[model samples]
Target chain A: MNIIVCVKRIPKTAEADIFIEKDNKDIKKDNLVFALNDWDGYAVREAVLLKEKFEGEVIVLTVGPDESKEVLTRCLAMGADRAIRIEEPIPNDGRLIAETLAKVIQTGPFDLILTGVQAEDDGWGQVGVALAQILGIPHASIVTHIHIEGGKAKVRRELEGGLEELLEIKLPAVLTIQTGINEPKYVSLAAILEAEDKETKEMTLEEIGFSPREPLDATIDQVSFPPTGKRAEILKGTPDEVVGQLTEIIKRKKGS
Target chain B: MSDIFILVEHRQGKIRDITYEIFGLAESLANQQGTSFTAVLLGHDVKSFADDLSRRAPKVLVIEDENLEHFNSVLYQKTLSSLISKYQPSLLLMGHSAFGMDLAPSLSVEKDFPLVTDCIGLTFEEGKLKATRSIYGGKVNASVSLRESKGYIATLRPGIFPPKMHGEIKGRIVMEASPLEGGVDVKKFIEYIEAPITGEDITQAEILVSIGQGIGGPEHIPMFEELAIRLGGTISCSRPVVDRNWLPKERQVGISGKTVKPKIYLAIGISGAFQHVTAMQGSDTIIAINKDPRAPIFSVADYGIVDDFQNVIPILKEKISDMK
Candidate 1:
């Protein structure tokens, strides 16, 4: 089976700090740190799992500028056989990126394509499904488990109320993996060395037969931390006094 | 004026709540822009829900297909793209639920339109659609505006928009035959495994007592659970609790877990982080108990306690039990 996994680079949760731009009240950017998106890690892991079961080449693809290579290399080190980077900073527009990725994925005769349910940066979980739409393939999002047998693929997706729906699709389909689907494998020293020599194919918008359209003019005007609240008073007293104070606090705070 | 399109979601003949919420949002946007609101439903026997939807929007389009009874991206996109070609809506709205997650991106790619997901709010500004969404999980909020003349598509986060109220605005329902274009074929539904039932629906629980790494270990869970039971609420935890295998993934609340909107949310020993807060910030009231006064959770919390959860939870549980 030929499988492809899509990954993205995002600001790391712990390192990201959002600040409003002076000129725009609606725009904000993080100045601190960035890393591979959490769910995309699951996508890469699922692809690696598929390769382990089906014995096929896993191609990890990311659409972004130079900064995205970090995630592609991480995917390579994580066991993807090869990597492809779309050498352009796809704008905040989800549609443009989906179109570019759809075109790129169509070039390969892939049996299945996997992507994280959403990027942590924008939390737009729609990209994988949108790519599948453009590619004209069966697609499922938030997939927690999957198994490929014969020519059909069986997938379980998490839904509301702890309910899961199992779906079956033919080969050459798309699926967006949700987190907790599988544990991402750590990059071994040997694998990192092997990935350093692996060939990475770079595709330009022109080469992919698509022109960069004006980014969906979505501009972040400002970013601000939510307001803080009053400090909690720690009631320290005799056991009886503490109990009385605690009861008052709970009644006043929780209203129960 | 440009038309606004909304996708109606349903399963087993029952309409999803997000569907109504998306329609409510679309109705508001359409009324504000003085444009028509068109609802498109794709599924088997989905036409039955159109009558109910007509009360919310100006027009309804039902594209019936047995293949679409379940969410099939291939069929939905083919049908949606055909509809888009027929009626070029200026903006398309969908619920940012599991189905929307699967369908929105694919439709955007097929139609070559700008798409945004997990939007909490939307408004038109200076002839452009402006969307507000959280960045870095829920640590910060950002407002974004769509660029040019191309159509805009977005998926609204659930619970952001309130449910639409019933009214007397009757509309028309247009039944469109399935386009049935060539796309990926869905074989069948293999099986539907319901996640093992937990005690309560934490996502809908009005009160949630969430535990963090500060809870010591698995043995300490009963203390929080006792409080939850006494309060007639449910118990949840941060990613670390699930990561430690102390709680099942279903009991976890964060970016990777379920988004909830409880009336009262209590955090014990949990440091507020963007990933963890985004899933629970919609709660009506938030209370954080952590030893570190600098814990970020205090930022959005309505009440904060600078103390150890271990010492606090047992006493609180006892107090609640005594009150009962």
Candidate 2:
């Protein structure tokens, strides 16, 4: 069996301060630590797990610039057989990205394809399902569980308000994985160093048949810091002093 | 027709609030464009939903089938694709929930419609569709515009568009046969598992002591719980805490978890991702304690403490107990 996993590199911004770039269309990436996207880590781990159990090859794929190759190497260290990087300067649109991935993925009658439900940076959650349509294959998104059963995949998808639905799809399908599907295993430093030598076959958009014929559907006009809905009043003084003030305020407010 | 259509989303026999939320946006946009908005519902024996939706828009389209009782992307996609071909509307809006997250992108691809997902704002500028989407865990917002297209598909995030009700409005109801020929056989539905109620329901709590990743670890949970006990409150948490097994699913407050509007919601060590904020922003009074002054939670908080929760929570707990 041949399984393909898609991953992307994103900045760790949840805990860090992010500043809008001077262009107002980008963020300053200098100080932020970059790593594989949170959900994609589970996707790669699931791919490796399926490969280990079913005796298949796990091929990791990424679409980005040179630095994004780091996520591919991480996947390789996590037990993927090989890596592929489609050189970047790709458009920011999801359809264009899906089309680009489809042009290369059509090269195979592969058994399964996996991707994160959404990228952390953009969070559009569009590419994988769009890729499945562009490829004309069955697809499932936000899948939380998977069990392979003879030429088909039985999967559970997470729904809103803590509900889950189970379904079965034919082989050669796409599954956009959600976080918590599996624990992303940790690899030692030596393993990562060894995997750095593993092959990461590179290809450009021209070589992969990406066309600029159709104009992009959507384009980012600008970006800015989110509007603070209603700024909070910061309590002043030491922790104990603040607690004393807070208790009074809580009592005042809690009483009506 | 260049009309706007909203896919009426329903579950367990009731129309989801997101359906109405999208309708709220479409109604105004349709008025601005001098065009009508329609609500297209797909369900089984759910004519009541269609009737109920008719009061919200100028038109309501019902496509009923027993097979559509539960959402299967395959059947819904096929049905929606045919309907789009027939109607050729300019826009079809859906909630960016699990349903749209699974259906909208793929259907947009299949129909060759320009698509946007998880939008917080949508407007037409110079006859072009523009959208506002929050990125980077809701720390930033991006304004995006779509190129000219015959039609488009977009998913709006929940709680962004507030649904408004007009006391008296009537709409035309149109019923169509299911466009899907024969049931979808390729993908078979198994079952839906509802979240188990392992303990207390946080939604009913009057006061909530909500914790996020900054709570440190499971070992520190009792300390937070003790604080909750002192204040006569229940313990709730952001998704990460539940994902880490620090709390049960019932105690989680977020988009995927329970939406709670307590009397007092004291958030500790939470960075207020939109997912979590959308759930608890309705609290009567909100307080946040996080060391990071830049945390997004502070924006929505009514009161804030910029000290390490380790510093404030213990003292606050002691003070509340002393008052009692």
Off by over 4 Å in 2: none
Model 1 chain B worst lDDT window (10 residues): B181-190
Q: Which candidate number has the best TM-score? A: 2
- For all predictions, the C-alpha RMSD in Å is 4.8, 1.7
Q: Enumerate the candidates' DockQ scores in order.
A: 0.43, 0.77
User: Docking category for candidate 1?
Assistant: acceptable
**Model 2 Cα lDDT, one tens digit per residue, B1-324:** 478999989888888888878888998888888898988989899878877888878888888898899898999999998999998988999999999999999898888888989999998877788999999988889999899988989999998898867536688889998877677656878898888997888999989999999888899899989988888899999988876778887899998889999999999999998889999999999999998888889999999999888888878877888889
TM-score of each: 0.81, 0.96
What do the candidate models score in CA lDDT, each in turn?
A: 0.76, 0.88
- Model 1: lDDT of residue B142: 73
Residue A126 shift from truth in candidate 1, angstroms: 3.5
User: Can you write out model 2's per-residue Cα lDDT over A1-256, one digit (the tens) per residue?
Assistant: 8999988899988778888888887789999999999888889899989988998798888888889888888989998989999976446588877877888899976899999999999999999999998888899999989999899999999888888999989988999998778766878899899999898999998898776545788898899887776899999997888998899888987788
TM-score of chain B of 2: 0.96
